[model samples]
Target: MDATTGINIAKVVGPSVSIATAGAILSISALYTPLLSNSARSQSSSKPSPTVTLPSIRFIFSRGSHFFPQAATFAAANFGYLAYYSANTAVKVLGMEMGTRTGFVAAAVLSIAIGPITGLMLPVCNNPLREMAELERQGRGDEVDEGELKKMVKRFEWLNYVRGAAILAGGVLGLAVVIAEGK
Candidate 1:
């Protein structure tokens, strides 16, 4: 079904999905890389490298602290937009003279679900950071045990994995919609 104007639905939604997918992948990398770097730095037996400044570490931490929410918001917004676009496309297809297509329906349904799932997961995953900050504000940061910190980190990582999976799934489903157009 052709759009009312000259707009191509595929062209718009295709890139939206791609952008959302790329953002999700980049966000995952950003979230995990520092943990790997810190782990390696801690495990090193050699004297601490003088080149790696504390300020640099703090800068990385600060960037990460801000990056997740922004990236998640951008990614989620794109997915949500894609969902809205796809739903409209589905309605258009249904009203078309050729009748309804299963592929468009599938895309609409998947898009509807993916937007909210991706949006919600990031904040849930970042809960540990909020908890830590709260403890610091309460003057009880020192009270948080290493074990608790480790558990929170683990939980965050796991949630990120799930979030990544959701993003990936959305990308794949979006691809399916693209491919279905070929038939």
Candidate 2:
């Protein structure tokens, strides 16, 4: 690969590593919140709360941490090889003259930017719905007073689709930037 492609690939490596680390941290936090909340509730209550049978965050982290490096290595190897083959095949089929350096630059930029952008936006779109569903499942289903419920419903109706669309737009913007720069 050319110097530009090499630099681009190297630049992406740090970001990808950071993204993986952040994902691990977020997963741990998700587990911790429920465990800590349950612990606090149990401590305050006369009757012990039902045993929370959720998986352990620490255990998941341990297992995931152990496997992540290997998984990342395999993924990088496979993905790089696939990109090489696919780009070569496409160039041959289309009678285009693009170099592997260009392909590498494109792939590196797109993957680096898109991966974390999607990672960041995914939680924004998903967390509220997940929270609302969890609340409903915990017996808070549509139990708000009529006036409050109406207000909430109206607010949600206005905001829900907007929030989702914003997440999508953010992802698209990231991809667009990568493509524009790579090209």
Candidate 3:
């Protein structure tokens, strides 16, 4: 096979590998978040209420708290794919010219991806938290306005769709870059 054909295959495969890696990492991280939160609660309160066992793994997966970590994974996967293409291109053009280490490249790409995605989505996440706090302030005892809460939930849902679109675009762009630059 030609070098171009080889690079094309790598371009197709890299994102899938990165996504699988990121997803495993995020799953492990997510398990730890509840543990961390529970530990903090235990430390702060003398007698904490019984931990609410999530009804099912599916329910747990559906929660808003899960979205950030998933977004993080998506960002990391995209960034990793981008960096691999960038480095592979560099190597083709500058043989024996040391490019950035894979880890550094991955981190930098992930950070760049995360920065914009998080910046855009975090406010949507915060809306529900802020609304709940407002409900508490009004002495309604954590009972938020149903309509407002629904609006916040819809906003978050829209953000998720947008994130999915961004990921798709990143994947397509990354592939185009590799195809265009390949020998």
Candidate number achieving the greatest lDDT relative to the actual structure: 1
Q: Would you list the C-alpha lDDT of every candidate in the order shown?
A: 0.45, 0.38, 0.43
Residue by residue across 76-154, what tens digits does model 2's lDDT show?
4433543443333223212344454344434334333334443553355334433444455576645423233233323
Clashes of each: 0, 0, 0
Superior candidate under TM-score, 1 versus 3: 1
Q: Per-residue lDDT tens digits of candidate 1, residues 20-129?
A: 75465446446653453243366552222212322333343466547544544443444444444543333222223321234433434443443465466446634554
Q: Which residue pairs in candidate 1 have backbone atoms (N, alpha carbon, C) closer than 3 angstroms, thus clashing? A: none
What residue pairs clash in candidate 3, if any at all?
none
User: Which regions of candidate 1 fall more than 4 Å away from where they truly are?
Assistant: 1-41, 44-125, 137-140
Put the candidates in lDDT order, highest first.
1, 3, 2
> How should the candidates be ordered by TM-score, best one leading?
1, 3, 2
Q: In TM-score terms, which candidate is top?
A: 1
